[model samples]
Target chain A: MKTTTVFTIGRQFGSGGRSVGRRLAEKLEIPFYDRELIALAAKESGLSETLFENADEKATSSLFYSMVMGTYPLGGGAIAGRSEMPLNDQLFLIQSKTIHALAEKGSCVIVGRCADYVLRDLPNVLNIFIHARMPERIKRAIENYGEDEKKAESVCIKKDKQRANFYNYYSDRKWDQSETYDLTLDSGVLGLEGSVDLIIAYDEMFRKTEGKKRMVST
Target chain B: MKTTTVFTIGRQFGSGGRSVGRRLAEKLEIPFYDRELIALAAKESGLSETLFENADEKATSSLFYSMVMGTYPLGGGAIAGRSEMPLNDQLFLIQSKTIHALAEKGSCVIVGRCADYVLRDLPNVLNIFIHARMPERIKRAIENYGEDEKKAESVCIKKDKQRANFYNYYSDRKWDQSETYDLTLDSGVLGLEGSVDLIIAYDEMFRKTEGKKRMVST
Candidate 1:
């Protein structure tokens, strides 16, 4: 607890990764960031919440591209060609900076936002990925997102693709790869509460060895 | 489990994945198969244990080439060009049959051997991939394998490559990709026991939901 620790969760769509991360943050008595990251980035960069929300977790979507390129507010004033930058890229930069700031403050669980890749250099950082079988994820999507079975299935694939593209675009490593993470668990099998318990118990080992530099990480 | 279930683990070298898998099998009161698989295949196929061991978990390596092929026992009879088959390929066929037989018998935990891909048709199977960061894996390699720091790191890479190549050559999917697995966990952060506990807890949920077939799986 003495050392600053950051838990970054990378997850599949409808996998309850965000919920489990929030529960883990609460159990650890640390701050949790999910959608609040968007708001923070919006505030920090003088960008509108709508822009952040539209660009949130989406990569190179035609809807966002057509509507957000030059139509959205560019804040109070901007340098030339600022509008030329892709909306997703701009939003991602702001959120990445916000994630770094939040990580520096103290211990926290930051969900999505490519937080794992952003903070990969830190020894105190633990990157966890939560995923589940297709059927389980579809069930969660139906229960939580109020989508019907067919819609849930399609939406799940689309959303995960967006997240993968978004993460892959910004990070050096491939998104959702097990090697890129410290721990990967199936939320479908463990459920949200069960996942929280596993993370807490696992993080204890990390807490004990946090400050000790095991070896030079390349 | 009310109905039979098989837990298949795919792991990186020196990641404690094999140890954790053995512990999980013990905790679940199920059979554990690792090197024992090679022994079983040798017995079932009338091949020498040494032949199986030499070809065990190994990919197409020229270093192991010329030494195993056609030199080992081809059993009591010859099936014409049977000796022409690479020793690793022969071992793999026997091991694959052994894995299928083990899964059919009852619940068990089978490590490596591409059991995940081999049993893809089974609804009662769970495929898990275990990996850890390079530094943690390197430290484990040094402590467990008695290799120096540099040797440990290099050995880690080589072993993982062999495992990956073996899995990829035998299985339909890539070895360690997250999508190929039902779950992936880091034993480095969780330690062997912690990893076992997590698997057990996660499998408990699976036990409850399994055998019921939430939907008709084709």
Candidate 2:
């Protein structure tokens, strides 16, 4: 079987990004994994599903610093106590393994869960972040949840903030920040299907170019 | 006549970025401006068109920072023995006027001249940056110019560095940096036509959403 490229999507809640990812995977004939990754990680790590799920895409306290010699200054030792949490390390390990497994299985679309950072240095991975205007996302949430505008608005804000917090904690970069991803799409404006089509075309082109590079080197 | 949104494209020479900008304008049925901008700036500034044309999107010391200091760093007192050139400052002023005038006239596409930074705070401006991989850009240049691969590659590298240097000098920001533009497209991967289509769609969506924002606010 030919080695396939893996696409990992990080999205804001209510942005229809998930649906876009799903459609993209279906169109490309690849597997789409979202929360399903938790189960896979659980099986691989021999930990309860919720252990991975509960920590799902949450940020851990990985302090930002550069070490001179061995000692860290500026209250670093004290903070290391809080940062050295066992649960966070275990969760990160699971997330990392799950991402690796998904890629190993061939082409797959993995949504959120620090998938981008987890597989950053991998040879054939495409990382994308999706976002949209506040109002559009709020409207989508209201429609999807069949709830009133205010409740849906709160849900949108809360969920996006959670994603941002998680991304900031684990990645050396910020979440939903366009610079972090190879491709960043305003899914709300691109319309779900159009974005999916664009990404598929982009990924195909990228892989073809990569193949040419390998052939030239050989 | 209705006002249409203006798009400013910044690109590197030999990147086929200029062709992409032209195709985009044609596809959108909007006027495309590149060298044409030089004529307009000359007319606006009451300077000889040749002077402005020769300067031609070249970098000058950043006015943004100098303005904060309440004086032009280069223009201010330096030495009595050495005479300084005011040519760039004049060109910059002229180009800025031309940009505003063009925006006022109707929707149009302006290529380079740091149009993104020129129209940075404008209400309905779309800024795009076009780039390509080194090998791809060199290939395009070779095909177009009938140059050897090595020569074409050197030309591509030299031209892009000049553009980057110019942009960074004037904007105090890195050139070809993805975060600076509303959209960044790889011309090599997307191809000129695909990029044009994608951008047209993006521009349309942006306008529709901006229209909706107005409707909601009013």
- What local distance difference test score does each model get? 0.78, 0.68
Q: A113-203, model 2: which lDDT tens digit per residue? A: 8887787666677677766656777788888867577687788878888888988877777776544665666564447876787687667
Predicted model with the maximum DockQ: 1
Alpha carbon RMSD to native, model 1: 5.0
Q: Per-residue alpha-carbon lDDT of model 2 for B1-218, expressed as tens digits?
A: 12588888877666677888888778778899998888877776556777777567566545643552355443344323322435465567668878888877888899888777777656677777776656666777888877787688778777777787767766744676544565666564446776677677677567654332211210
Best by TM-score: 1
lDDT of 1 by residue, B11-76 (tens): 998888888888888888999999988888878877678977877787766655566464545564
TM-score per candidate: 0.76, 0.61
Clashes of 2: 0
Clashing residue pairs for model 2 = none
Candidate 1 stretches with Cα past 4 Å from truth are: A1-5, A22-31, A59-88, A104-107, A121-124, A142-154, A208-216, B1-7, B22-32, B58-90, B101-109, B119-126, B139-155, B193-218
Window of ten residues with lowest summed lDDT in model 1 chain A: A209-218
Candidate 2: C-alpha RMSD to true structure equals 8.6
